[model samples]
Target: MKKSLLMLNAILLLTAVSCKKSTEGGNTGIIKTDSSTTIVTDKNGKVDSLSESSTIVDVNGKKYEKTDFVYKATDGTLVKVIFKNDPKESTVAITSNKKTFTLPKVESKGGETVYKKDDMTARVKGDSLHLEQGNNIIELKRTKI
Candidate 1:
């Protein structure tokens, strides 16, 4: 379980970096995720985090029930991810720079629903999500509305 979390955290970093590049011309990097809130860059290139009262995620075995993040991608596509608590699941459908990504029909890890591609793989567990693209991996938790 520790190893899995570590991988998830790594993927989170990758997602942060990818978002940064998509908007900032590939020169900035900011990574933040912990037991409470998840801070990520929005479509307008501003750092934002959801309210603690509205967003929740499990950390240290505690469940955090949160809402979805509704925002425009860098390419102007509407995107959002709904985070869950019990049973660990998430609903994510996003399109960036004319690229559409959605949930896959198969689950690659046990009962975990997988959304993947040739070089990218995302594993959703409740409110947490781990995405890997090539050597880049990112963990996304919490939701910002």
Candidate 2:
């Protein structure tokens, strides 16, 4: 009887050892059960610790959600802007009903010589002016008004 019991114990131990498996893939904590289903686990084998989802990325931040108006910088009746691309550091953006020009490195950050009415719907910068339209027509002038 003792010999039989010892042999049974040895067999059980071997079976358990053979059934155990070592996980690979550098501990991503994600296990694919099937083509349509997946299981995510944590360091301690707990599930649902962290979740991930798709998100929209905006490089210009929330400027599009503010308003639909053009920006320009001018002094009195004199326009400073003359052409686009002069201020290589400035970016021009537009929307359906408006446009926006962001100059992170302009004479004044928020200062713009705005125009919307008449045949002169234009933005005047220091020594340059940009025309606005449905597409991006923002330009940077190198001169000062």
Best-performing candidate as measured by TM-score:
1
What are the per-residue Cα lDDT tens digits for candidate 2 across 1-145?
A: 4554455447647976995445664533433222232333434667532222112222333211111122233322212221122222433333212223343223433445555533324565443557655665655333221
Model 1 clashing residue pairs (backbone): 11-137, 11-138, 11-139, 12-138, 12-139, 56-64, 57-64, 88-125, 88-126, 89-126
Residues 63-89, candidate 1, lDDT per residue (tens digit)?
Answer: 645544444333333334543443455
**Model 1 spans with C-alpha error above 4 angstroms:** 1-79, 82-92, 96-99, 108-111
Model 1 RMSD vs true structure? 16.7
Give me the displacement of residue 143 in model 2, in angstroms. 7.5
Q: What lDDT would each prediction earn against the true structure?
A: 0.50, 0.36
Go through the candidates in order and give the clash count of each. 10, 14
For each of the candidates, the C-alpha root-mean-square deviation to the true structure, in angstroms, is: 16.7, 28.5
